[model samples]
Target chain A: MPLSKAQLLAWLGKLDAVYAAKKEYLTDLDAAIGDADHGINMNRGFGKVMEKLPPVADKDIGTILKTVGMTLMSSVGGASGPLYGTFWMKPGMLLGGKEELDAADFARFVEAGVDGILQRGRPERGDKTMYDVWAPVLEVVKARAAAGDDVAAIVDAALPVGEKALADTIPLQARKGRASYLGERSVGHQDPGATSSYYMLETLRDVLHA
Target chain B: MKKLINAVENVVKEQLEGMALAHPELTVAFEPTFIRRADAPVAGKVALISGGGSGHEPMHGGFVGKGMLDGACPGEVFTSPTPDQMYACAKAVDGGAGVLFIVKNYTGDVMNFEAAAELVAADGIKVQNILIDDDVAVKDSLYTAGRRGVGTTVLAEKIVGAAAEAGYDLDACAALCRKVNQYGRSFGVALTSCTVPAAGKPTFDLGEGEVEMGIGIHGEPGTHRMPIGPVDALTAYAAGQIIDDPAYTRTVREWDGSGWAENTLTDAPFAKGDNVIAFVNSMGGTPLSELYAVYRKLDAVCKEKGLTIVRNLIGPYITSLEMQGFSITLLKADDEILKYWDAPVKTPGLVR
Candidate 1:
């Protein structure tokens, strides 16, 4: 089945709640190596996205996603702002005027969004950034779609790969963002950006399954 | 955190409100949160706009006035301001001459300001963005996001603002600003960690007798921690870091009209016989008297190194929100830079 605009909205709503509930957890992770505001930034960004959703509720998925991206870009005042803002905005630009996305279309959307993240952050794999999680997850998404899996199955198959990638980030020394300032000390701490990306994927899975 | 703030969310807004009430010559906008001089966009003068996280007071905002910045954008505490704020402030402050964005080298600040520059350029307004990265503590630009922009930012704003006031065009103003960044170096030490109001706890913990050396403005851990000692020893250590720092090269992104371009820049080491502007800055909570003590040793150190101090500024000009520490900045000034440094500036945070 194709993923409807309603499912996309539900995924964003679930993300808002997930970030709100995990704000302190993410902040604590960031406190270990970063400036300790990831939770506050993500929660605040999603809150702004929620406010912008009602206005674009009846619009195409591209418009709704673009609104979320713009709101986050303007509201979240951190590196994540532009990083994640482009993540959604690029996909929105590619998916312009689309109201529903099938498994192949959704896989392409994820691929394009991850490309945006790469272009904006210039983060390589093993850099202990959100790209670590996204890179592996994107691979799984592309493979599952090529295998004729449904949208729900694609997301389900990608979540465990993402979770493992997030865990693998704990041993890698950061080479980008504020965490890179820690050098060797950045090891042994799970990357806050990867963890947040995992939560986002997990939220999508729940929305798809429901 | 035991702060004077009424709520975590309203901290930046409330403080900006109080600043607006105090400085009538400046105008504060809340919707996008930017501060500008009351009489901005002076006919043919180039507009200077700067911004960063809000906790470092008397910086971008407090320096907005005649002979200084035309506009300032304040982000959340230690967080960069959004691009929309920069675009709006640039539009509001740009005179016929164009706008120059003085951005620090933090990842967020650099990206946001870059985005804003693109927006402004697309609108057909002439724009240029210059980056300041003077902190000497961070060694490699290959791994981390270069050196954090520190005390030199204040000095750059004053010097570049004066140049703009003296009829420097967009390219000239940007070139001079870049010169200031290359000519300056800074190093900081923290006595204690600070609490971000939202986090409600200290960003890091330091033992009673330990100090974080090579610290940045943010409360993150520094290069290393050492046993706390007398004032003179710490002052010499910071001064030594700046004086002894080797030449550094990094690739910086510049807005080239239509898109971004990588520009490689180098910061040369300070040498003997170089005339310098010695700045002793408090990290918010340090008393002025303690800073004087720091300066007392800094002066002797500069003399010992054969560097001449033509001008000196001592106080909490660029701070870290009561973090109980201080940083030392040494700018090797040339004739032109010295002339602009001596120019008149009137703002809430600085007056000359």
Candidate 2:
């Protein structure tokens, strides 16, 4: 089955809830190497996304995603705002007026969003950023869609790839973002950004499977 | 953990409200938070807009007035303000000339301000974004976010703001801002960590006998920690770091008329006999007497290093909440910089 607009909205809702629950955990991870505000920032951004979703509920998926991006851009201060804001906004621009996304469409959406992150953050793989998760996940999604898998199966395959990527972020010294300031110290701690990115992917999977 | 506030979530809003009430000359806006001069969009002059995290009191916002920044955006405490705030602020303050964004070197500040500049440019308004990266603590651009913009930001705002007040256009304002950034260098030592209201805990823990050397303003861990010592010894260490630092080179991104362009910039090291502006700034918790003590040693250190202190600014102008520490900034000044420094200025936090 193709992923519908309602499922996308549910994914956003799940993301909001997950971030709220994991705020302290993500923040503690950041505190180990960063400024200790990732959880707070993400929670605030997604909370704002939730508030904006109701107004755009009847709109197309592209419009809904664009609204999420715009809200995050305006409300979530810091690197995540522009990085993740573009993450959604770029894909939304490509997905304009789409009511539902087939596996191929979803793959295109993820690829465009990941490309936006790369453009905005200039993060490369193993730089210990959200891109670490997105890069591998994008690869899996593209491969699965090409194999004629549905959106659900594609996301299911991408989730474990994202999970492994998130785990791999540990033991890698950060070369981007505030965590990079810690130098070698950034290595033992799991990257908060990667963790959050994994949660986002996981949320999408849950919404799609349901 | 004990901070004077109504609630953690309401901290930034409440503080902004208080500032609006206290500083009638400055206009504060909510929903998307920004503070600007009451008489903003000044007839034909360039508008200076700068912003960063909120905990740094009186910076960005406090510097908004006749001879300084035309507008300032305050993000959540210790977080960079969003692009929308900058876009709205640019719209609110862009005089006929143009708007220049004075961005700090932190990733969040740089990215958000860049986005805002693009938005402003797309609206048919002329815009430029210049970066300030003067902290000498971080040694390499190959790793980390290059050098973090520290005490020099305050100096840039004052000096470049004065030039803008004296009729420098956007390009000129941006040029002078960049020059100030290049000529200035800073080093900090933190005696303690500060508590973010929302987090309700100190960002880091520092033992009583230890101090965080080469600390940034955000309470993040410094380059290294060492045994704490007397005030004179600590002051000398901080001053020596700035004086002895080698030249720094990095590539910075600026918005041209059309798009973002990369520019390789280098900050030359301070030389003997250089005329300098010495700034001894408290990191919030440190008091005036402690700062005076630091300045006394800093003045002596510069003289010993064959540098001349032509002028000085001593206070908590740029701070990181109530963290008990201080930073030293040395600006190698030319005649033009000196003249601008001496220009008359009036704002809620500064008066001359």
Candidate 3:
């Protein structure tokens, strides 16, 4: 029922691989409504995080996460840099010195990450941004955690919700970020940030199963 | 993707290297790339900093030197620089007087600069971020990212950078920059979309005779597209937006030494008999002859409207990396602005 730092490191490594394999696909999705570098930038950021993660693998979860945050902030050059970097950095700060995380800690971690993103980007649900996924996905995460699920079940439960949220990004007009430049034309394209968010949760689910 | 570079990833690095080699007065630092004046941290003077995506060459970087930006942070192609770069650049150039950040209104640039401002202030350096939203095409900020900062940024940098060089305090320089921005309006049209090296293709597609109106620097799909028209008609259309724009009221956030302060500002419409600086800027691909042609039409329109082009900048001052387009910026220059504009500058892009 507990997720160890080892598993967290493995999850990060898996994320590095997943982003590397799917970088072009992500960029393709972004090409529809936004600039087509979401995948490349994410891959580059996570790749750097992976290279930096090894030295801190023995540290507490918070330290590991903060390292990833700093790596992404410096390596990534787009809105994703600060957004995803904050997502990790906030959870890491809250979970400092912890050797492992239980369901409550994991739920609070996701919640803190979402709150950090909200504070940084100021986006609301249906803005056709990553927030569109985070709002509903957080609801799912909180419900699963409250129901006494472990990190695996909580993340497993949240994966489909995140994917659906990604799909739902279609038909929504963007009101934030570069996609807003397209206005009504931004509809019918899956938000790239939402897609990456889905991938992130999906990576966690795969880590749990492994 | 036929480019002059030997490799795509090395574009920014090689450019920085070339800049450092060519200009002995500038210092280009990699590993979180930033370009600062070789004589940075000029004591007793306010330090000016500005940057954005790298593709808009000769902008934040080329303008970094004697009478312009004290430092600049260049990001990936058409992408905003990260906060750490800005923070490092600010720390490298901050005089005891303070530092002023000239930021474009794009979401990434605004967020990055805001984050950097907080980080820099925590390190005990005074910081103020002045937003430039002079592009009049977006129409509304409630639903959009305000107006995209374009040609007006060029004018702001030159004007405010001179003020800083002339010993204005941080608050006074920020006020002058804000005034310059409020009085400036810009509009641009694109004959072709720019091809980012990373994207490996044009940002958007255009037909043989199609043209995009109200195009932003990043090749975002524009307000409208129409059949290609004569240069005179096209220039007139873009000029009309800047000239006839009604008073626009918007709220922007400013850093007031301690925390963020929200200031609601309004821009008055351009009136007759105004003395102005008419800037005709290329989007990088257009040659000077075409720019002059656009300016030729812009001059006629201003004359008919009773506006005088007392000074003008005609060239690829703020470009979109070989995107075949041009933008026009007109600022009602007061005596202070004109005097500062005529101040001695020795940047790679501008020399006076």
Candidate 2 per-residue lDDT over residues B1-352, each given as its tens digit: 7779998889989888899899899899987889999999898999999999999987979999988999999998999999999999999999889999999899999889988988899999899999999988898998777999999999999999999999999899999999999999999999999988877888888998999999999998888999999999999999999999998999998888998898999888999999999999999999999999999889889999999999999999999999999999999999999999999899887887
Judged by DockQ, which candidate is best?
Answer: 2
Task: Quote the lDDT for A198 in model 2.
Answer: 92
Better of 1 and 2 by DockQ: 2
Which candidate, 1 or 3, has the higher DockQ? 1
* Among all candidates shown, the one with the greatest lDDT: 1
Runs of candidate 2 with Cα error greater than 4 angstroms are: none
Q: Residue A84's C-alpha lDDT in candidate 1? A: 85
Q: What is the clash count for each candidate, in the order shown?
A: 0, 0, 0
lDDT of 3 by residue, B65-120 (tens): 88889999999889889999999999899889889999999888888888889899
Structure candidate 1, residue pairs in collision: none
For model 1, what is the alpha-carbon lDDT of residue A121?
81
Instruction: Rank candidates, lDDT, best first.
Output: 1, 2, 3
* Winner on lDDT (1 vs 3): 1
DockQ score of the complex predicted as candidate 3: 0.71
